[model samples]
Target: MLEFVVCFTVVAILGGLLLQRLWHYRAEAERAAVQMVIANIRSALEIKVAQANLPDGSLDFTFLTEENPLNLLKVKPVNYAGEWYRPSGADIGAGNWCFDRADKTLLYLLNNVNSFEDSQTKLLKFKVKLTRLPHSPAKPSGAPETLGVAFEQVKD
Candidate 1:
């Protein structure tokens, strides 16, 4: 009887540890998804700047999902938290983006960042920034001479 009890206790402890690890993995996966979205957006912008020769590349929030020169639209269009990145028309909901033509900067703002995580105390906000530089004729074309993008998480 004592042997059976010890085995049950060990099983319970292992199960609890597994569950905790599972949650951690889920949170990490969520973070990675968000990072992927930012990377794709940055890549598209870089291509557009080089190929299209866009001086400023100022675009609206809807441009991220629009089909054309950049073609960044996804069929599902869902973020990590299973949320829709709607167009910035009358609503301008989650996953909104803006590009400044004058400053050559692109900014993405996502709402309800904490919803992606299990802990209530882990409040976060995601901001993606892209900057474009002036490319000269003397520069090479192997890399992006005109643009760069960065992503950051903010505590809110």
Candidate 2:
């Protein structure tokens, strides 16, 4: 009886530990996937900006900020749920990507909330906007300031 009890307790402890580790790994994987999507969107934005600049040099960026960032991508991510004006959690559900046109923000609903750090919100919000790079001292004083688009995280 004593040996059986000890074995049972050991198994329970091991199982709990394994479950905890799995959750940790799952959270890390989720974060990595979100990062990869953000990187791809940023790359697409850079390409769009470059293409616009090729024409003349003066390119209007106001339109880009209002446009859906995913539209710039050749192929949208499979998990993207599409655009919504003002979506609730129930509207989009968990483990999906949604763009809120009203707020001009891209949101990622997290599937695993256990290991995620944000206690206030289960979703991650990001935005694409025009950003100006600092003028390089190496360049001449008369040189034009460099402008680019940035994919930035927004707290909501």
lDDT tens readout by residue for model 1, 24-128: 776566566656665776676556545444556554333432322113434323532222333232233345444333323333344444436443432233444
Residue 41 in candidate 1 has what lDDT? 60
* Residue pairs of candidate 1 with colliding backbone atoms: none
Query: Using TM-score as the measure, which candidate wins?
Result: 2
Best by lDDT: 2
Clashes of each: 0, 0
Candidate 2 displacement at residue 126 in angstroms: 0.9
List model 2 lDDT by residue over 1-156, tens digit each.
999999999999999999999989988988788878899998988888888789675577778889888898888888899999999987777888999999899988889875357646788888988899888879898777788889898975
lDDT of each: 0.48, 0.85
lDDT of 2: 0.85
For model 2, the stretches where C-alpha displacement exceeds 4 angstroms are: 56-58, 114-119, 136-145
Report the Cα lDDT for candidate 1: 0.48
For residue 121, what is the lDDT in candidate 2?
75
